[model samples]
Target: MLKIKNLYVSINKNLIIKGLNLKIKKGEIHIIMGPNGSGKSTLSYIIAGKPKYKIEDGEILFNNKIINNLKPDKISKLGIFLSFQNPVEIDGLSMYNFIKSFIKKKNNNNILKNIYKKCEKLNINKKYLSRYFNLGFSGGEKKKNEILQMLILKPKLTILDEIDSGLDIDSLKNILNNIKQYINKKKKKRSLLIITHYTNIINYIKPNFVHIIYDGKIIKSGNKKLIKKIEKYGYNKFIN
Candidate 1:
């Protein structure tokens, strides 16, 4: 579903991700872990197609089409979703209108039922539908809101950036469980690219591939066993 080859990205001429290559075919979860400034978030933003971060070289192929030069909106239209590490609060935008507007723009004939189901799965109170989008929401509430978006959108590929950072245990469980539910019920591959530091998140979602990135490059790649090593020894052990 997603392939990023030899990606070299820079923001205002400062390089972030260098020589990064990764692939996500289908029915797979990939976790990207690295120390700060090691290009984890940079890779996420690069694949998300954010305009500011220029792709100096390489190509991002989504569903086999070159998307390196495409705008973020166009990327989303092609069924790619990025759940931000910190969801911004839009004071004037009601969640109801914001979600419905997005769905309408997708122009998919059938999405309403799944939308409400998503809200319910994320434990977002129906009343929250009337509230401003993320405005003054607690940290966990904000995380739940992101999951709510993920569930509703049901994009082909969901790139979650530190989604577990601010969420409490209960909220985290709900969000993770809902993701599994979405996969099982939909029977869609729905590739997940999770960028996180917490092994607890991985415990809930089994990743087919685990990649260790450091110093702006993929230092190592392995399977679920790598998660255990990280949990047992931490990134410090992997540095050497």
Candidate 2:
């Protein structure tokens, strides 16, 4: 559903993502792992069409259409949704208000009915509806909000950047359950590009393809077993 070739991105004139490449097939979940400062997050931003990360080279194609120069909302309009690694808390912006506006903007009338069902599955209460977006929310609450958005938007390609970080075990399981259900029970196939540093998240959400990204490029591509090796030996040999 998403393809990146010779991908390069920079911020403030400093190159961060360099010559990265990958392919995400329809209805597949892929994990991108790398050492610190390896440009993993930058690649996600580039694919999701964030302007702050200027692109110097490469091509990002969604559903076979080139999206290299599209604006963020334009890319989102083309069925791409990026869940931030650090979701910001916006005071005075109620969660219900944000979600209703987003659902209207996405024009996902079909998905409207399932919002409450999905929220209940994610353990989000109606009481939390009036709460501002992530304002004073626990780490797990913020992550649950991300999953809620994903469930509501139902984007074709969901790039989850470290959604597992800071989440407790139960909350992680809840988040993964929602994602798995959303991906599996879809009339329109949805794909995922999950960027995470630990394998703990993989147990909840199975990855069809796992890539080891290092030094601004992917050095290894394999199945779920590769993650086990990384958990045991780490990325020293892979990076070397």
Candidate 3:
């Protein structure tokens, strides 16, 4: 569903992603694990078309079309969803209003019903929906809010960055369950690219491929077994 070829990216004149190549196919779940400052999050931002990051070279193709120059909203409308590591709070906007505006389709009774069901599954209280978007919410609540948006949007390609961070065990399990359900519901029509530092989420959601990235490039590609190895030895051995 998504492909990146020899991607070279930079921010504020400092190179972040260096000649990175990755391909994620439909129905596949790929996890990228790397230490902080390894360019893992940069890859996600680039794919999401964040304007701050300049693509010095290479191309990003989604659904067989080049999207290197597309705006963030355009990329999102093309069925790509990115869950941020830190969700921003907008004091003036309520969660309900934000989501209602985000969804391109009409907001009808059926959509409301489906959204409520997803909220229940994610354990989000109805009252929270009426509150300002991510305003005064705890870390866990912010992450769950991100998942709630994902459930509502139902994008074809899902990119999660550090989704497990700050989530308690129960909340983490709930989020993972929701993600698994989404993938299963879409069958082979959906794809996921998860970037994380720990293997805790991997325990619940099995990835078809696990890639180890270092210094803005993927240095090793393997399967679930790599998760165990990383947990046992950590990323130090994978560096260099």
Best by lDDT: 3
Quote each prediction's TM-score.
0.93, 0.93, 0.97
Clashing pairs in 3: none
* Per-residue lDDT of model 1, residues 84-104, tens digit only: 988888989998888888775
lDDT string, candidate 2, 1-240, tens digits: 888999878899987777988999898889999898888888888888877888889989999999999999899989999999989989999887788876765545544446667778999886787889899998888888988888777799999999888888888887888788888887248898899998877778888999999878899999999999899999997877
| Model 3 global lDDT (CA atoms, 0 to 1) | 0.92
Q: List the RMSD of every prediction in angstroms.
A: 2.3, 2.4, 1.2
Give the 10-residue window scoring lowest on summed lDDT in candidate 2.
104-113
lDDT of 2 at 182: 80
Tell me the spans in candidate 1 whose CA falls farther than 4 Å from its real position: 105-115
Best by TM-score: 3
Report residue 186 deviation for candidate 1 (angstroms).
Answer: 4.0
Candidate 1, number of clashes: 0
lDDT of 3 by residue, 81-194 (tens): 999999999998988888888766785676677778888999999899889999999999999999999888889999999999999999999899889999999779999999
**lDDT of prediction 2:** 0.86
- Residue 40 error for model 2, in Å? 1.2
Model 1 C-alpha lDDT versus the unseen true structure: 0.85
How many pairs collide in each candidate, listed in order? 0, 0, 0
Off by over 4 Å in 2: 105-114
